[model samples]
Each structure stands twice: as structure tokens, then as C-alpha cells.
Target: MAVTLQDKLVVALSSRALFDFEEENQLFEEAGSQSYVQLQLTRLTQPAQPGVAFPLVQKLLRFNADGQHRVEVVILSRNDPVSGLRVFHSAQENHLQIERGVFTQGRTPFKYLRPLGAKLFLSVNESDVRQALEAGFPAARVFPDSIKSAEANPDEIRIAFDGDAVLFADDSERVFKERGLNAFQSHEAQYAQTPLPPGPFVPLLQAIHLLQTLPANQVPVRIRTALVTARSAPAHERAIRTLMSWQITIDEAMFLGGLEKGPFLQEFEPDFFFDDQTRHCESAKYAGPTGHVVHGVANPR
Candidate 1:
């Protein structure tokens, strides 16, 4: 039988998002791909440092530690095959068991997500992330400088998501953006019984929820999730209803209304946080590893 990733929670990530390639990336930006390739070749033996998404990836990979292969991590990079050598080496140095990779050599890499059965995609490149999200896969543009996750929960994977645009459709957010908060609040309250549509991250969240439901003895690590949103009170009801309707449960939920998400996220100390708006991501990054989901009305084309 042909090998398949159908049952595994596959996460496709870019090289830059996985490792600290900022200096080499700057060289690529200022000089060119050739110079960048040469530099990577020169440092081929030196492993790169872990970047923003590293901790999250590390924890997710733990699901496979029991030899059940419940998770798979793929390097979907724009770097050339030469640079990819360095990436794989870095993974080895960091003790990450990443085996699959697709080095596009500057071509767009999102197109490969479908074939890879990727549940999530993380990249430092906004274009790749937006394209992946547009293609209906959960993708996030990781803040390269975002603070790393706290070491408080090594055996547990904690992920936090924004409600609108990240986990639920941005319909209410559209109203909030165009009409005003009152209209948005009214819309959500009136449709409190109605479940909002699934956003880009729904599939990923569903997969995580399924993994969390596995018997403790069958899994290698614990998974916890949260819904941290700006919605409060009446507006919050719709978000909760939506999750209930989907039959998916998160470990925690924070309806902060319009408060800055940073402080709350700091307390939660998630391995990663995903939000649609860049402003929210900006504040959340300081709390822990954060990704900007470039979708919905707030991120207009």
C-alpha cells in the first residue's frame, strides 16, 4: 500500500519560521538568492537557531514520540535545495524529527499543501500565508521576533486562537468594521442561537480537538486550546454557540471585549496564538509566539 499522511496531523512550515534565518534572509533581500545560497552553503554545518514558531512545532512533534506517528512536520520552504540542507541539519541539531521537505527555490510553496495534507502552515512570508489561507488551509504568518513560549508546560501543547477570522467566520467582525460596535453587538445578539460559519482555522482546531479526545494512554502528550477574542457578553454568546454547534470544545475562552490581548495571553502562556488583525498579533507577540492570520475584512485585498 502507498504511504499516506491522511491520519496524521500534518503541519507544513517555512524554513524562516522554523529557524532564525533573519540574517541570511536579510542577505537574500539585500544581495540576492545566489549570495544567500552561497552563504547557506558556507554555513551548511552550522545549525540555525530556533525562531518564533519553533516551540509550537516542538510540542506538536511530541505527539509522534510514542512511535504511533500521529503527527508529521514538513519543511515547505522557498529556499533552494542547497539551503534546505542547512534546514534539515538545523532540525537535526535541534533534535526535531522533521523528515519531509519541499524546497521550492523561491517559487511559491502553498500549492504543495494540498498534496501534503497539511492541517496548518506557518511562515514568515505574508504572501505564502495569505495564499495558503485563501486556498482553505489554516495558515499563519509568524512574527519572527515574537517571544518564544514559556517552558512551563513541556509535556503539554497549549494553543490559543482568536474567535473572528481565526476560528469563526468574520461576519460579525465585518459588521463591527463597517457599521460600528453597536451594530456588531446587535447582529451577534440577535443571532446568538445561530452558529457562525467556520473560519480558516476550523479544520486545524477540529484536528487538535480530536487528538485531545484520544485516551491518555494512547497519546504521548497533552493538548489544550483556548478561544481568546475581543468579543464580550452578548457578542461572546455567538462565538460559544458556534463552537457548541460544531461539537468542539476548547480548554479555555477569554472574551476581553476591546482590551489589549497581550496581558491576558501572558497569563495563559500559550505555545502559540493566532489572530486575524495585525494590531492584535503585534500586542500578542510580546506575550508569546503569535501568528497573524491575514484574512477577512480587516485584511482587505
Candidate 2:
């Protein structure tokens, strides 16, 4: 029988998203591919330091500590196969239980998300992330700017999500983009009883909510989810109704209108946060690990 990832919550991430490759990336940018390859080869024995997404990945993998294998993290990178050797080595050195990877040698790596049954794909490259979103996975462009909230809660896994585009379909967002806020609000109000179509991250949220339903004693780890979105009041009603229609319950929901989400996210201190627009992601990153879901009308790139 062929092996399958159907039953597991798979996270496919890029090498740079998992480990610090900035110095090597700089070499690749300035010198060339050959320099980057040589540097990776030379440093193959030296484990790379943890990158921004490491904390989130590490904690996520911890779900399998009891041998249930509920989570799997795979390296899906654009790095050459030779550099992949170093990625695996670094994972081993850091004691991260990552057992699988694909090194595309500079080819776009997002195409492999389906075979892996990836619930989420994280990469520093916006193009790969965009492609993954188009492929219908909860993909995000990770900001390697900083590792926010290093002091993660040992027993709880906290994930925050934006409403439109990230969790719900970008339909209303497109309306807002082309038709203005009043039109957007009215559209959502009209559809308050309707469940918005699933967005890129819906599967991820569904998988997580499923896990949340598991008996606490059986899982041994607690999952705390949040909807930190920009839709406020009248617009917010639709988002709430959508989740209600789906029977998904997030622990917290912040309808921040148009206020800066950074400080509020800081108070929440999530292990990871997802947003569709760059400005929101820019603000959220200051509070926690941020993933840019470059989907919908808000992100034209």
C-alpha cells in the first residue's frame, strides 16, 4: 500500500522559514548561486539557528509526543538538494522531529503541497505562498523579520486568524476594494445569514477545530484559536454568523474595525497570526509570529 498523509495535520514549510538562512540568502543575492551552494555545503555540518517559524513548528510537532502522530512538519524548500542536507541536519541538531522534505533546487516548491496533504504552507517567498493559496491550501508568506513572543506557553497552542480572505472567502473583501466600506457592510449584512465560502485557511481552521473537540485527557495539549479581524459591528455580524453556521468556535474574536491590530495582538500573544494584507501582517508581527496570506483583492501581488 502506498503511504499517505491523509489522517495527519501536515505543515509544509520552506527551509528559510524554518531556519535562519539570511546570511546564506545574502550570499546568494550578492555573489551567486554557486557561492550560496558552496556556503551551504561548507556549513552542512553546522546546524542553522531557528528562524521565525521555528517556535510555532516546534510547538505544533509537540502534539505528537504521545505517539499519536497528529502533526507532521515537512520541509518544502526552493533550496538545492545539497542545501536540503543541511536543513535536515539542522532539524536533527535542534531536536526537531521533522522527517520529510523536498528540495526543488530553485524550482517553485508550492506545487508539492497537495501530495503532502498540507494544511498549511509557510515560506518567506511570496510567490510560492501565492501559488499555494491558489492551490487551495492555507498558505502564508512568513515574515522572517523577527521571532515574536519567544516565551511560548508550554501547554497551549495559540493561533490567530484574520476573518476575510484568511478564513472566510475574499468575496466581501473584493466588494470593499471595488465598492467602498458602506457597500461592503451592506453586502455582508445582506449575507449575514449566509456562510461565506471557505477561504484558503478554512481547512486549517476546520482541522484545528476538530482537534479542539477531542477530549482534553486524550490530547494532552490545549488548542486556543482566535479570529482577529478588521470587520467591525455590522460587518462583524456576518463573520460571526459564518462561523456559527459552520459550527466552529474560536476562543476569542476581536472585531477591531480599522484600529491597529498590533497592540491587541500583543496582549493575546499568539504563537502565530495570519492576515491577508501586508499592513495588518506588519502590525501583527510586532505582537507575534505572523504569516501573510497573500490572497484576495487586498493583496494584488
Clashing pairs in 1: none
lDDT, candidate 1, 126-181, per-residue tens: 99998999999999999989999647688888899999998988887889999998
- Runs of candidate 2 exceeding 4 Å displacement: none
Q: In angstroms, how far off is 112's CA in candidate 2?
A: 1.1
Q: Candidate 2: how large is its RMSD?
A: 1.2
Model 2 C-alpha lDDT per residue in residues 45-119, reported as the tens digit of each score: 999988988988888887787888888999999999999999999999998999999999899988899889999
Give the CA lDDT, 0 to 100, for residue 122 in model 2: 94
TM-scores for candidates 1 onward, in order? 0.98, 0.97
Report the poorest 10 consecutive residues by lDDT, candidate 1.
149-158
Task: Output the worst ten-in-a-row residue range by lDDT, candidate 2.
Answer: 146-155
Best by TM-score: 1
lDDT of each: 0.92, 0.89
The reply for model 1, stretches above 4 Å from the true place, is none
